[model samples]
Target: MHTPLAVEHGANLKQYNTFGLPSNAQALVRITSESDVRRVVDDPALGLAPKFILGGGSNLVLTQDVRACVLKVEVMGRRVLETRDDAWIIEVGAGESWHETVQWTLDNGLPGLENMALIPGTVGAAPVQNIGAYGIELKDRFESLDAVDLITGRSVTLHSQHCAFGYRDSIFKRHLAGKGVITRVRLRLPRPWQPVLGYLELERKIAETGITAPDARQIFDWVCGIRSVKLPDPAVIGNAGSFFKNPVVTPEQCRDIINRDPEIVHYPMPDGTFKLAAGWMIDACGWKGKSIGRAGVYEKQALVLVNRGGASGAEVVTLAKAIQESVYGRFGIRLEPEPVVV
Candidate 1:
């Protein structure tokens, strides 16, 4: 007979979350495989209990100790499902480190995920937020994903259309949140890989390096180099990558803000919407390098909120709210937090 899965009660969660906030799970179980999840589902004690699925803990804000049973995803695998003249289909376990997975793809001669290198999180969590960097987003390369419903313990495969991807938003964050556990993710990398150098920083890299034609590895290295200098390392600083999403606004609203603050940084989206830089707004409001309690805005990037050692999730939330209030008062655009606050 297979050994029973162990549930750890009063599990410390500080080490699990990127923010390093002190919290505890009432009960925690490590789900290393699909069978582990099924075991939890079939168990009489846990079957009907509320659940919280955790991956890399890179994009979360735990405000308090978790009351529901926490299922920590640790499944792992990666392989090329199919190789065609048009494209390559690759599949990876949900718990695989996203950065590592990107590197693995490059090592295996897959080139599509280079622009998204150094993104912190697990493959499973990537789709939940439609994680993006440079000029590429997860939705851009997504093909399909396998997830198991908590209520029924039945597996379902979802395509890109079913994901309902939006800017830092997804169906997983809406209809599927806490209801399903993603098991695997598939990526479709088209043949004749084209580097996404449209982002300003990447263009500057091209100018600085004088390499007009760069390959996938070049773009991956560039992205990693840029992120290393720009974003704080979570291990050292304790932060959720980008605290706030770039708020999208109408053209008229953009014009109104631009007229008021001529120096504001903004980008025009293909949809005719304007995406105002949240970092610039926070910096404009004088929040950069500032702190409230043990939480503070990162000195290097105002978009990041860091734990100034021993910070609680509540302090971070307080600091975020203050920034939001200031930005709204000045620009009339409410900043939405990117990380899911629990």
Candidate 2:
């Protein structure tokens, strides 16, 4: 039986990620079609332990040689299948770059995805984190997704409710995280657009420009512009954008932190918890631009940890642990990582 597969081991994974850290893979495979995905999974020649789904490779950290086969999804397609009076449901292949899908939505004049612009990674991985930026998340626009279960080789459509979305989390990440690979994702985008200026940065951007009712394309461009300017292009600095997720704490904890430091930036989580910006916490703790050996915190952003040069995965983990420990010690709040360290 003919099959598509990668013919290499100990391949340098540096270029595979935005982080540009040196790592190795035991095996690598790119599946261009839905059948190809199954074929690679069912390959007897390659003893299957488990497999890793490689998407945009932006929101992950390669800390060691992959002990599992890496299946790089190449399935790419996009279509506008349904239009409501105020919205359209767009079906996008899981392998499509999430940003590409966002761009497509804007190019077609869809409005919902404008706030989530410039987040790196594939459409499939978006659900993995229930990815968000500015003020919108994948869950906000999520209609459904189809994924192939590795164990049963069955396709299942998981609706947004089934995805179990939280702050940068989902069922695909929590329960069935490594169980299967997503093939398609459907999104319902707004047509009769409403501007979301809840995020401080976004609101500030629009306020500074004095633009009212900015269209989806302008909002997308503004987000891209802000991110490109504020965030160091990973191609140059070697980093996974935003290394830690914002900590959501109880309302009591929020008040306590506020009492301790009145200027602490905190947002109320939907579940009566207070969400604190991990970047602000880290920056306040003085970790920005701080380097531990070869691994250093990004100078521009406190939330991002960088591989200055010759840093190993273990080293990054160690530094992150230190930051976590330090943050907890200072504020009595635990910091959680945003990237998948695999």
Candidate 3:
């Protein structure tokens, strides 16, 4: 006989999200396996309730109490699934800590994931956000993923093509959002691993140390060091990293902004577009280190919004919207938030 599904009603959610915003889940369930997800889908009452799949909660801003059934993914495991002449395939459980998984790979001599070290959240949330840092995105090493359909309770596997990965986005954030729960992710680390050092920070690190040909471990350490100095620890001070995405604009638009503000930070994309630095723009607009209510913009980085001691989720949203308005008024460009506000 199957074990009874334990559900926590009116579960406190302040601890689940990185922002530490005050909120509660109407019903919460710890999902430890694919079967656990299927069980929730199969249950008459829970099956009928709207569902929300939660991972490490790093990429989220809970603006209100969740009325849906919250499935907290806690599944954990990691293994070298295959070692081929061309690549090494590593499969990781959805609930595995993303940063820990990166460290684990490096510890086991798998070098490709080092550039993405120190990223917050869970493995399952990685593909959903197509999380990237330094110069490597999750898609760069993606193989396939396993997920259970919320409606049908049937498990499915999807490859890169089906994922529709874009800049910090994937199918999970679009058509498949809230429709299924990712259970496991398989990463394909290409053989003869090469370091990705295209970011400006990495370049500076290379020049500073005169280590032009740094290895994967060095790149990893450099990324960790850079991020640690820039971002505030959520444990100490509640925050969701990078409140807004760097806005990508057409060449003409970029030039227009450049004409207005010569010192605007902008980078050329491979497709002839330009990605303007959102944080720089916010800082330019004088929003950095500013606060609205108890929510405040992080002094160290304008892209992050923090909860200043007992701040509510509504306050966080208010601050973000105010910053958005300020930026839009000045730049005529809307900054989209990186975090999922709900």
Candidate 4:
């Protein structure tokens, strides 16, 4: 016998999203497995209706009440799937907390994910965003993922090439967006576990501590400490972390900006492009600690937009737009928001 789908109508989503923005889903179903997703796809009413896949809600901005059926991915599991000579493969449920998973890997003697520690979201959502921090990205550690097609209710496994990962993006965010549900994720933590210390912050930590050969746990702790000091806790102060993506510009554009402002923060990419700091641009445009309605720029980090009290999604968008305009007007570079505005 098949389990009955337990659907909740008019579900309040304020608590689901990290931003704490108020929004309601017309219908919400907690998806626990791939079979649950298939059932949703097979249902007569829901199958035809528009669907919205919701994970940890860390990288989302709900602008209004959702009319579509919301599939809240709640599947849970974590284990070392394979222990290869060169790498360890760990499979995780889509719903598992990203930071917790990173900790779990380290606890289990795995250390490749230390650089991405403290990232707020689910394991499933990581691939969709190709989430990165410090010096490592999700793509670097990714193995493959299992997803259920919304239309056919068919399970599919995709590898790195299929994911089409770019800076904070993947196929899941593009052509396959809202068309399927990621059920499980597999991570490849390479052996030999060399610490990624190229990032300025990590380098600074090394300089300060005089511990050039820090372990994975130490790196994880440092990353968490750095993030805690830079970002506001969602429980205490609602935020979606890094409101905008650091814009990539040509060398000519970088030089132009550099000529105009001698102290602009930027970094060279492997592709020969320059990644300009969005937060620095916003700060240069004088947006730090500024407010629009109940939404405000975080004082410590201009890239993050925070809810002063009970800020609405529209207020957040408005503030983001204002910041974008100001930064563009000054830097001649458009800042792209990292969050998916629903």
Off by over 4 Å in 2: 1-7
Give the top-scoring candidate (lDDT): 4
User: lDDT tens digits, residues 1-342, model 3?
Assistant: 998999999999999999999999999999999999989998999999999999999999998899999999999999999999989999999999999999999999988999889989999999999999877899999999999999999999999999999999999999999999999999999998977888898999999999999988898899999999879999999998888999999999999999999999998998999999999999999988999888999999999899999999889988989888998999999999999989
Candidate 4 collision pairs:
none
Q: What Cα-based lDDT does every candidate model obtain?
A: 0.94, 0.82, 0.94, 0.95
Q: What lDDT score goes with residue 227 in model 2?
A: 87
Q: Alpha-carbon error at 67 in model 2, in Å?
A: 1.6
Q: Which stretches of candidate 1 lie over 4 Å from their true place?
A: none
TM for every model, in the order presented, reads 0.99, 0.94, 0.99, 0.99
User: Which parts of model 4 are misplaced by more than 4 Å?
Assistant: none
Report the CA-based lDDT of candidate 4 relative to the real structure.
Answer: 0.95
**RMSD of each candidate relative to the true structure:** 0.8, 1.7, 0.7, 0.6
| lDDT: worst 10-residue window of model 3 | 192-201
- Per-model clash counts, in order, read 0, 0, 0, 0
lDDT of 4 by residue, 1-342 (tens): 897789999999999999999999999999999999999999989999999999999999989999999999999999999999999999999999999999999998999999999999999999999999998999999999999999999999999999999999999999999999998999999987899999999999999999989999999999999999999999999999998999999999999999999999999999999999999999999999999999999999999999998899999999999998998899898899999998
Residues 1-342, model 1: lDDT tens digits: 769889999999999999999999999999888888889999999998899999999999999999999999998999999998988999999999999999999999999999999999999999999999987899999999999989888889999999999999999999888999999999999997888889889999999999999999999999999998878999999999999999999999999999999999988899999999999999999999999999999999999999999999999999999999999999998999999899
